[model samples]
Target: MTTMTTRTVAYPADGLTMVGHLALPAGTDRRPAVLLGPEGMGLSDVERRRADALAELGYVALAFDLHGGRYLSDPEEMLARCVPLLSDPDRMRGIGHAALDVLRAEPRTDPDRIAAVGYGTGGAIGLELGRDGVNLRAIGTVNATITGRPGEAARIRCPVWAGVGSEDPIMSPAQRNAFTAEMQAAGVDWRLTVYGGALHAFHHPPVDHPTVPGVGHHPQHARRAWRDVVDLLAECLPVTEDQSEVQGRLLTEPR
Candidate 1:
């Protein structure tokens, strides 16, 4: 296994003291980076683990917080906070930019080679960042089929990949069509993957707490979505060849 360093970083965004998880790959040489966003419930162990996994793959990853260090398990609380936030493009951009700033400040991060991958509300924020004209290498979102303001998508300068569950009620067929239309009209390099028979947040792991209706975990699809996200990163913001070899050797080394 490729050993990595992980830490909690506190920063301010949208009047909240956001606490994000930062993961750094082994070695000091600069590497490509990813801005990771959690689901509507906020930053949890799942997202932090994802950041660590990205680091193990030789990328600096920052899993950003949504609720100022709080992880909401209550569906009502999550909806109350996320519904309005998702509607405001400016707010989403602010959060994304704040996390981007944090990621760029890392000494090991390559500012020119960065991608944004988010889930649920986090995915919407990543799209907002792209629409705000942020220079991202790629944007990958899951379960966030949201359309931006008129002509704003034209500002996106990188490829975008979106994943959704075919049966997701929150991201209805109409919403997906609108989102695709916006991207197509803007001339973006975009694609969408629908996990058949899955419901909303299917990419997420099973949680002990109660969730909203239509939200359920699909392990098979979740793994596939993760692989797809990794593929997108590999295509758009690959790590150096030497780093790949190092990671390969680490994985093969005996204990």
Candidate 2:
């Protein structure tokens, strides 16, 4: 196993003290990095583990905060917080950029090689960063098929990969169509995956607390979607020998 390190990082964004989890691969050499965004619930263990997993693959990964360190178990509270944040593009970009700055500030991060992978609300924020013209190597999102202003989307310079549950009422078929159309009209390199029989937040593991209606977990598709995200990062942000070895191990490891 590759040796790695983890820590909590606090930063300011939108007048909130955002707390992010940072994972660093073991080495002196600079490595490619990823800015991970979590679902609307906030920066939970799931996103933290994902950051650690990415670090084990030799990438510096930071799982950013969405609700300033609070995890909302109440569906109504989650929506109440997220619905408004999602409506404001600038707020989303502010949050993402703050985390991006933190990622880039790490000594192990290769400033030029970075990507964004997010789930649910975090996914939408990642897209916002891309639309804001952040120089990301790639953008991968799950359960967030939110559309953006075409004028801003046209500024995106990276490829986008989005995964959504086909039965997700929140991200309905019409929403997906609108999102795809915007991406297409903007001349972006984009792809969409619809997991059959899954619902909103299908990529997440089962939660202890009750979730909102239309939200459920699909373990099989969740693993597959994560694999696709790994593929995207590998294709766009090539790592060094040490990292590549770990990456090989990660790819072949049994679930």
Candidate 3:
């Protein structure tokens, strides 16, 4: 059985109230926690599914909200709400910082193993935490940008894995290459995975089933990317019970 909790956090200092879905491993063991930030479309079903999947991996994952529960169907409306934050840069940093603080404060989370992951705009926010020198174990981001480049480059204290689509027009390959150069120069333990033939948000593979729109999902790539993420977590966070079983099977079963 999995443990799931729904909670809301109010950052009065920032005038942002966020709703989060916290999922934990079964039983009383305090698990490593992950904070998930959603894309410009807000916290959607795909994100929740990802969070649940993280729980299945035996971590407490909090899919935190960034839009204050205000979602927009029209692209313009979504931009209307998001553009301000994107423009200022500091707003996203503050939003991510507040949510991270709240997630770590939870009793069921292992504060030392806490990490952050995000999609699209949310991924950028996750990177901001790295730039803020939050001392997380690892960070995962998909289809996001690297703004304030060298300025924030020195702040990342964790391994960063960035999943990108080779075909994504928004965050182009040239940009990724440039960003990689910056990351390398800064001595960041980072991996930039460019999925061949994939498009933006390609991890939203289930989006085709009457689910969220504009979320491009790729099953094979999604699984691969998730495995990569899980591997990163295993390295950075404390191990879990299920992971022990899996390792046992691998060594004893002899392939």
Arranged by TM-score with the best first, the candidates are: 1, 2, 3
Task: Please report, as a residue range, the 10-residue window in candidate 2 with the lowest summed lDDT.
Answer: 238-247
Give each model's whole-structure lDDT.
0.95, 0.92, 0.76
Evaluate residue 83 in candidate 2 and report its C-alpha lDDT on the 0 to 100 scale. 93
TM-scores for candidates 1 onward, in order: 0.94, 0.93, 0.85
- lDDT tens readout by residue for model 3, 109-183: 888888888888788888888887887888888888565446677789999999988788777878888878888
Top candidate (lDDT)? 1
Clashing pairs in 1: none
Superposed by TM-score, candidate 1 places the C-alpha of residue 145 at a distance from the truth, in angstroms, of 0.8
Q: 7-82, model 1: which lDDT tens digit per residue? A: 9999999999999999999999999999999999999999999999999998999999999999999999999999
Task: Report the CA-based lDDT of candidate 1 relative to the real structure.
Answer: 0.95
Tens-place lDDT digits, model 2, residues 1-255:
548999999999978899999999987789899999999999999999999999988899999998878899998999999999999999999999999999999999998999999998999999999999899999999989999975788988999999999999999999999999999999999999999999999888898997989999899999999999988888677677665577678778597
